[model samples]
Target: MSTVHIVGAGIAGLAAATWLLAAGRRVAIHESAGHAGGRCRSFFDETLDRTIDNGNHLLLSGNVAMMDYLRRIGAEDQLTGPSRAAFPFVDLSDGSRWTVEPNAGPIPWWILLSGRRIPGTSVFDHFSALNLATANADATVVEAVGGEGPLFRRFWEPLAVAVLNTPAETGAATLLWRVVRETFGRGATACLPLIAREGLSQTFIEPALTYLEANGAKIAFNRRLRAIEREGDAVTALDFGDVDVSLDSTDSIILAVPPAAATSLLPGIEAPLESHAIVNAHFRLEGAPAAVIGGMPFLGLVGGVAQWLFVRGDIVSITVSAADALAEESTERIAELTWADVAVALDLPASPIPPCRVVKERRATFAQTPAAEMRRPGPRSPLGNLFLAGDWTNTGLPATIEGAIRSGEAAACAVAT
Candidate 1:
């Protein structure tokens, strides 16, 4: 069996290791952090007496690779799906609210026929999407949605932020096509949202580690890889602090670290370096409503302080995507703004705001700019045995959990080949 050395214990690395182990290969994983799950980690909040994730991550039924990975690690049951394909969207300016539901068929004919969901939008509003869907795969999202329309501003813009983690003008059209074609285009129910009922560590990462351990895979924590040595087309060894760990010429290596870390290790290699930020605010409430705030797991915010809110028991967490403006805002200021929006939307009685926790990921994802899109590297690197795997890699999609899993699977396949 071939020995595979994977650097970075993030989702990508863990997925690759899991696949290799299942295939009866020798594997060793090195992570800089003490624990696994780089971005999708969770920890116990002693003060709140509950588990909290670093950030909220949602999955769609279209994410086959991610779902498959979960099953492989024996954590598929930890995910809960909403009853229907619906998302609540609220416009704070006018106190108007609407629920966008999936169409009866695979193609979302409701969005094209019904105007109630997307208020102030007409059937023509979705013409651009249809046109873009049939356009050349190399086209950009900006080129597709160039005209001014309410749908472009409210629907497409917010959707772009959620998917690409960037504005529609900068996001890639090809990637969006893959998302729409694979999900809504394939089947109406394929877009149903899946959320983790428990913490991410419990639902995804920890189980993967357990499976790896059971398969005799070695995992080293706080072992930061400093450099790589190559012989001909293969990577000869890896440098971590004072140790120079050697690898067989045929042994494969998957660099699953973040883009910045990857670039630092391989100075001359080209990889996208653009970054986007995500700001999340968590509020502990005394009591939540009997019926959940709308039937949807999350809601889109337009012209509101809160972009998306997740109601986990009494703790209400709000997420702000592509939060460049909120980068320098104080936690107290953000909490105040977000709570005001939440109170209005959820009809909360005036009460003293409970303790608040704020999380800011400055480099949460790569900027989905056209220039940045071109820089995303594929699984194969210039070095034959050294492969790349990460959401930031060229997975065709944006920096999401699904994209990360796809990249890992691609790298594993490359190693096997």
Candidate 2:
């Protein structure tokens, strides 16, 4: 069997390796870093004396690709969340709180109830979603939905920023609409939140590595691909910094690195160039499982610097998405600002922030503007035997775990043929 050479042992590469290996194809994964998981992993923070994920992510039941990937790697039981769809939100300005709880079925009858909707939002405000269906591909979230109303400020803006990882003013409306159609449109059953029970590496990465190794797959860490040696429409060899890997005629390659890395390896490839940043501040609090919001593990915040706050045990992680400007601030400043928001949301003391570590993922995700979205390429590369797999690729979704997994699967399918 021709071995499938996968570059970058991130989620995309790992996902592609698993699918191909299961199909009886020989697989070898090479990663530049000694570790896998790329952006979706956890690490110990000495300051906090606890393991903290680089960024907090909230997955929904409607994320079909991610769920399938987890099940395949036998990590389906590694997640925990509310029994139903309950999104707790707080307005920092007025100290108001509410939970957006969708009904069990696809019909969003819950929106009709004032208590279930966002505070100060009328029942007719929910009708703004209808505009999404008619939104053209070039429409931004602000343009698609009239950006003024209370519903847009309290609901759409936050949701768009979280989903697209870009300001709602420039976020691609089509991508946000697709997310809404998949999760919220399907109702509470599909929108049920699922977060890693332990951590990202434990739930998504380590299990996948175990499965791949158990199935006799080769995982080579610290083997960076310096260049791609091509021979007329086919990848002939891969040049690492110290060693060069010569590919056989029958063998195939899967390039699953980030867009910038991919472009360096295969020049002139169309990919999202502009990217946004995400700032996360993890604070270690005193009590075990310090707090909960509406029986959910995470809480959404409006009129604050922190967009979302996630609690796991005594550690609280505050996330600010599309935070390019915030990412530039000093770590101390970021921590202080985020901790203030956390204090208000969690009803903790305002003074003396807990032991905290601020993480800034500068290129966390590509800019999900309409123009950037249009630049995303498909799985098929110019080389006949080489395929591309990454969240940044044209997966018809934002750069997310679901999109990353789907892109890998798409690459695997393309390689198989």
TM-score of each: 0.95, 0.99
Which candidate has the top score in TM-score? 2
TM-score between model 1 and native? 0.95
Model 2: lowest-lDDT 10 consecutive positions = 287-296
- Lowest summed lDDT across 10 adjacent residues in model 1 is found at 288-297
Backbone clash count for every predicted candidate, in the order shown: 0, 0
Q: What TM-score does prediction 2 earn?
A: 0.99
User: After TM-score superposition, what is the CA distance of residue 259 in candidate 2 from its true location, in Å?
Assistant: 0.4
